[model samples]
Structures are given as C-alpha cells and as structure tokens.
Target: MMIEDVKLSIRHRAQRNYERQFDERNRVQTDGIVTLGRLTIESPNKNMGSEYVPSPGRLIEHAFAHLPPDLREYTFIDVGSGKGRILLHAALHDFKQIIGVEFAAELHAISKQNIAAFSAANKHHPPISGVLGDAIDFIIPDGKCVFFFYNPFGRPVMERVLENIAASYRQEPRKIYFMFLSLKHERGNDADANRELLERQAYLRPLKSWNANRGAWIKLQFGSHKLTMYETADAGNPIKRRQRGANGAAASHLE
Candidate 1:
C-alpha cells in the first residue's frame, strides 16, 4: 500500500479508537446534516449553523478543571447537543444536573438513547435529560447555570439564546458561566453573535480566553477552537457596579 494510504488508515483507526473510549457511537460525522434551507430549529438561510460534531473529552476536562469547585452544583447544559457525547463525559464528574438541548428531533432522540445507556452503566451520576426544541425559545433554569456551546447556531439564534439567558439573570439574579468552544468569530456567525451580545449586555463579564495551542489535552494538533469563559458579575464586585453605572449613564445619555 502507498504511504498516504497507510497514513489515512492510521488516522481512521485513531478516530475510531477515540470514539470507542468516549461513547461516540451516535453518528459523530457530519454526513446526514440538511444544508439547503432552514431545518426546524437550525437556520440554514439566516445563520446557517448545522453540522454534527462531538466535543473532545480532553478539552472539556481542561475547561471544567478551571471552574470553581462549587460550580459542580450548577446544572450542566450543552446547547446544540448533538448526541449527548458531552453529557456522558460530564456525567463522569459530579454535576448537580445534566441536560442536552438539540434542535433536531432525531438528534434529540439519539441523545436520549445515549444518556440512557450512559446512565445505566454509571448509575451513581446526577440527573440527565435531553430537550427537543429551538434553543432560542427554551427557558433557562432558575439558578446558576453552566452553559456549553460548540458553535451551535448562527448569529440570529445565538443572539436570541443569549437574550433568553440574560433575561433569566434579570429575573433571578444569579451566576451563569458560559464556556464557548471554537471561537474564531465572524460577523453573523455563532461566535461573533455571542461575543457581540455579551459585550452589549451589562450583566456578564468575560473572564478568560484560554490558549488552545498550549492545551495538553486531546490531540496536540486540534483546531483553533479556543475555550473562552464568561460569568455573570456579582453585585458587590467593583466591575459589576461600574458596568451597571455605565449602562445607566448610556441610557440617560440616549434620552
């Protein structure tokens, strides 16, 4: 066989072995995605964010390691959860609740199946549930939340989702940590929309932008999908007060 063929075979074997270890049985490839027009929750016309890819287990582990120990109580939510791959790995930890939201009904069903299988094997984990709907309309849980997004949707949907999340904070006044993966950021895309929305909103603070190149987890040569973390500002934090005051000033100046 040719050297190139040997390399391709090795790559396939590595990917399959990775899946075998990380519960990637539920169609991790992007072959069956509908790309023509808007499909149910995904916007193929306006934003065009539809492709199925599982989050790397090593990246997730590194990200979670940065979070505070108390955040283990926060409900873990994967926005645009494809097949519950992240949920299965998250269950390996001790989160309070685990949830996956997928727009496609078929994907949602598969997520349910994955969760069921994972739960059956690891019976000591927390509660896990998968929701089927557009993430824009999905209600945020009424407490601290750990939201994960892997370039799920385009700008329009991301803006709406952030609006919903911000509104939840407005009503309940609690902490929210956003862990965004693969943030190259372009206008009208998921990463850009999320960054713009968060910047425009006054309640949250962008905390860290980790260097994915320096990352030791997963393959050394993964994509440049940097994991950025953001959290809601606490009432007493100086930055929060200043942000609120600046927002008030901006509103007053507009009048």
Candidate 2:
C-alpha cells in the first residue's frame, strides 16, 4: 500500500478503537461510518451529503472551548449530526437547547436511540432531540444559536443553508455562531470550500487570533481536522459594521 494510504488506515483504526471506549463511557453506540450508498433514507439532497463520520470527543471539546463563554444563551445545533455524538456532548453544557439534524433514516434512528441512552444515564441535561430532514429545507430557528458543521454536505447545500441563515438574520437580527471542522489535507473536501464560502459573507466575522505573517489563525488543528469559528458581528462593533457597510449592494441585501 502507498505510504499515505497506510498512514490513513492507521489513523482510522486508532480512531475506531478510541470511539469504542468513548461509546462505552457515554453508554451509547455511535461508532463507525455509513457511506452515502449505505444510507437508507430517500432524500432529494442525499447526494450532497458526505458519509457519516462521528466527531471525536477530544476535538469536539477543543472546538467548543473557543465558543462564547456563556453557552447558556445559545442553542447548539449540529447540522448533519451523524449519530448524535455531538448532541450527547452538547447536552453536558448549559445551552438553551441541543439539536442534531440528520437526513439519513438509519443514522437518524440510531442518533435518537443514542440520545435516549445518554439521557437515561445523565438526566440533568438540556432538551436534546434529532430532526430528520434535508438541511436545505430546515428553517433556521429564532434566537441566538451556535451552528456546528463537520463538512456535512457538498458546497451547493452548504451555500443554501448559509443563505437561509443570512435571510433569517435579516428578518430578525440576532447573534449567531458557526463552527466548521474538516480534514486538513483531504482533496476535494467540502469543509475547505464551506470555510471559504463563510469567509466571503460580509456580515459574519471570524473569531480567531490572526497571525498576519501567515495570513491565517495561529492554530486551527484538532486531531486530523481543521476548525474555523465565526460569529455575527455585534451591531455596535464599529470595525465589522464598517465592513458590512462597505459591501455596497450585497451589504444592503443583508438589511
């Protein structure tokens, strides 16, 4: 086997081993991958979705730590939540609500079962539920929210989802946070495309300490994935306000 393929195989094996223990500790069965062909649900946008790969707990904790200090004010929504691994983790927080949106019928059912198992063992968590539907058709909920994405779908679906978010913000201006994590070196990865798409949004502001020399965040690595965070600029933040104003017609559309 090629050296790169060998390395990848090693990583995948290690990850599965770790997740088996992770599932045991959390009393849930959330390990393994289900390719697009294996997904049993029939959805118009199913092809846009990538395979179901559960997020690692360590990387999740690293990413969540950088979110707004008071998670109580924001609802955690995991788009393409796979088997609800992230939802269970979010339930440990004090968020107003915890939700996972997965379109695949098989994965969605598994996620619901996992959530039930998690809740039974840990009864003090916030409201947690799974919504099975195409993310493109899912309406952005009212109030502040922290949207988490792990390269759930292709660029087209992601673009529509972002547009919906912007439109929702226009109808009712509110704070929103976005966390996107994806493989760092994988070719044709949607995470990279989605991150660039998000960067192009005039109204969204990236949250990270910049390294001007490198022209990127000082650190964005979480295991094998790269994580990028953003938040809707506060109306009063003069810098971002000015940025939004400078976008001309595009900025006007957001209003």
Candidate 3:
C-alpha cells in the first residue's frame, strides 16, 4: 500500500479498536469503517465513487442544529450509506423513518445487523431499514424527507439521484432537504459541479450551505476532513437557485 493508504489504515484500526471497546458495553456494533474497492460490491457500473468513510458523530450533530424541528416528521434517507452510521444516528434522534441504501451486499448485511442490534439496545429508535441495491435505482418515496450524500458516488450517479429527488418532490410536493458533505471542497470540481447541478435543476432550489471554511480560513485544518451541508428552499416556491456568492472563500454556494 502507498504511504497515504498506510496512514489511513492506522487511523482506521484505531477507530475500530475504540469502537469495539465502547460498543461492547453499549451492545451495538456501529464503529467499523472501511473503504472498499469497486470489485467488493456487486454494483451495476463503475460510476459509484467515493470510499467508505463515516461522518463523525460531531458533524452529524452540527448538521442537525441547522435543520428544522419538522425533522421529526420526515423520513431520513442516506444515499451510499455504508455501515449506516448516519442512519443509526438519525434513529437515535427519532426520525419518522430511517433508511440506508447500500449496493454492497456485505456492507448491507453489516448495516442490517447493526440496525437490529442498535434497535435492541435502544428501544426508542424509530423504524429503520436497509435497501440493498444501486443508489441510482432508488426512487424517493412520497413524503417529507431529508437526503444525505457523503460524496457517495461520481457526478453522473449524483445527477441521477438528484433527478429522483426532484421527481419525488413534484409528485408529493413536500418539504425536503439535501445535506451533502463534500470532503476537500475546492474552487472548481465535482463538489462545485454538483452544487451547480443542484442550482440549475428547476425542481430543486438552493437554500444555504455550511462547510469547514464557512467563516475565516482556519490554519492547519486538513481539507479531506471538512464537511459541507446544503439547505434549500423547502417544499415549493418556484425558487431554483439562490444568490451567487462572489466574496465567499469556501465552495458552499448556499447563500
């Protein structure tokens, strides 16, 4: 393995060790995190981008803070939800329903097992399920919902997924939120490209965005570890894209 891969291995091992120790007492297995190769999953194509990386518990909390109280009434869906970390967290907060869509059979099985164990341990969690298939094929159910994407797939897959969300909105016409956490967001790339894509979509509207460099540029912060959350016009109001931020330092074009 390359040096970078080696460092990632060390950190991953440390995280697993800590989770194993803690999950033993908690009696829930949700600490394992690993990035797999394309061959690992029985996927339909190679457009599935990104590796298995869990959003830190803190980042999830920070995101929830920005969401509305109506969150309790919406179904939470995590696309490319490997290991179902976000689903597990959403369950604790009691979303009406929690779903994770993972194509990898092995990872899907692990998520199912984790959800069962977690529900057994915490009876207060809401209904949780796992969809074992390609994310591109997922049809957003009719209802108030929140979709989460951790840079799960490449641009092509993301565009398709967004189309599904927009279709669901037109069919149901309810409040929706797309919380996207793009790692290492730069000036121009898929991160910006996806944001631009969302902005251009007539059905979907851009509300607001928050990322690592939201304010003043912080020193020594690694870009890969950063998070960006996009909030858009809820429900329908004919708003497609928000204002184009010209003076901003980061890539989140939510304003």
Candidate 4:
C-alpha cells in the first residue's frame, strides 16, 4: 500500500479505538458518520449540507486548550452539532453554557438523548442542550460565545451564518471566538471552501497565539487536517483583502 494510505489506515484505526473507549466511558452513543442520504431533515439548503460526522474528542480538547484561561464568561456553541459529541466534550470545560445546533430531526433527537445521558453521568457540568432548526435561523445569543464548526455546510450557508453572527455583533458588540475544524472528507470540497470564506471575513481575524506559547502559531493536527481559530476583530479596524500585514505578507499564514 502507498505510504500515505498506510498512515491513513493507522489513523483510522486509532480513531476507532478512541471512539469506542469514548462511547463506553461516557455511556453515550455518539459515534459513526451518518451520510447525507440517511439524514431525515429537510431544508432549502439541504444540498449544501455535509454528512454528519462527530468531531474527534482529542481535536475538540486541543481546540479548547487554546481558549482564554477562564471560560466562565463564554458560551460554547457547536454549529451543525451531530449527535452532540462535541457538546458533551464542551461540558467538561468551564463555559457558562453549552449548545448544539442541529437541523436533522433524527440526529437532533439522538443528540438530545446523548445530552440527557451525559447530564446523568456528570451532575456538575455546564448547561448543555440541543437546538433543532436550520443553522441560519438559529439566533446568536447575546453574550460572549465561542462558536465551533466541523465542516458543517457549504460556503453559501456558512456565509449566511457568519452574517448572522456579524449582525448579532453589530447589535451587541461582545467577545466572539470562532473555532473551525476542517475534516478530510471522502467527497465534496466544503471544508476548503468554508475555510476560505472564513478567512475572507473583514470583521474576523485568525487567532495567532495558542496555549501558553505567546506569539506561537499552532494548528492542532487531526491526521493531515487542522483546526483553525478566528476571533472577532474591532469593527473599526476591519482587515482588508490582500492587505500587507505586520509580517509583510498579504495576510497571516493562518488567515
């Protein structure tokens, strides 16, 4: 077998092992990928949506590790949250609240059940719940929030979602962090397109520092893919496209 293929095989095996343990330890059913054809929800942008794949637990933790030291003031939201795996993982943190937005009725139901199971297991975790509706229709709560995405939908839908967030910011300016993990998919190019669209947002900028390493650039690995982080920029100092920055580049490498 080719070297990359072999490496991929090993990664898949490792992911399976981790997930099996995760499900057992948490006593929740949050594994497996449900293809688009299998999803039962209907929406105008249904064709723009990607299949349901739970974000890896390790990846989720790595992304959260880079957030501010104290998360008590922030709310954690997983857009297009499938089966609430990420939501369950978010509960381990100190966020004020945890929310999973899902459009699929079948997957949404499963996510609610998973939340119930997780709440039963851990009594002191943050308040976590599932919201069943189209992502664009889900109102952004007026508070400091860390919105997360795992290649949920196409660029068009993502643009709409970003606009919604931007609108919310306009009304009530607050701290907002966007955490996006680009998954390696077997079909379609939504991941790449979504990442590019995120970079193009003028009101958003890539988060440069991570963990305790000041000024250090980091992209936590998920096999060959990486999780990119962005935060709201001062609306007055919007980043223009292809504008040379401090490093004398059109944009930061992360952007």
Q: Please report the candidate that would top TM-score against the real structure.
A: 4
Q: TM-score for every candidate vs. truth? A: 0.74, 0.82, 0.74, 0.84
Ranking by lDDT: 4, 2, 3, 1
> Model 4 over residues 203-248: C-alpha lDDT tens digits?
6778886423432222222555567898887534433345678878
- Total clashing pairs for each candidate: 1, 0, 1, 0
Better of 1 and 4 by lDDT: 4
For model 2, residues 1-255, the per-residue Cα lDDT tens digits are 997676667666766777787789779998778897877766878777889888876567656777767888788999999899989888888899998888999899999999988988887999998998888888788888999998898899999999898878777677888888787786865777888988887778787631112222223223366777888888433222223455454443323
Model 1 worst lDDT window (10 residues): 235-244
* Candidate 2 vs. true structure, TM-score: 0.82
Best by lDDT: 4
Candidate 3 vs. true structure, TM-score: 0.74
Task: Assess candidate 3 and give its lDDT.
Answer: 0.68
| Position 155, candidate 1: lDDT | 70
Off by over 4 Å in 3: 1-26, 38-40, 185-189, 202-224, 238-255
lDDT of 3 by residue, 143-243 (tens): 77878877777678788888777666656667787777776634333766776675566555454544443433221222245454554455555434334
Winner by TM-score between candidate 3 and candidate 2? 2
Estimate every model's Cα lDDT from 0 to 1: 0.67, 0.78, 0.68, 0.80
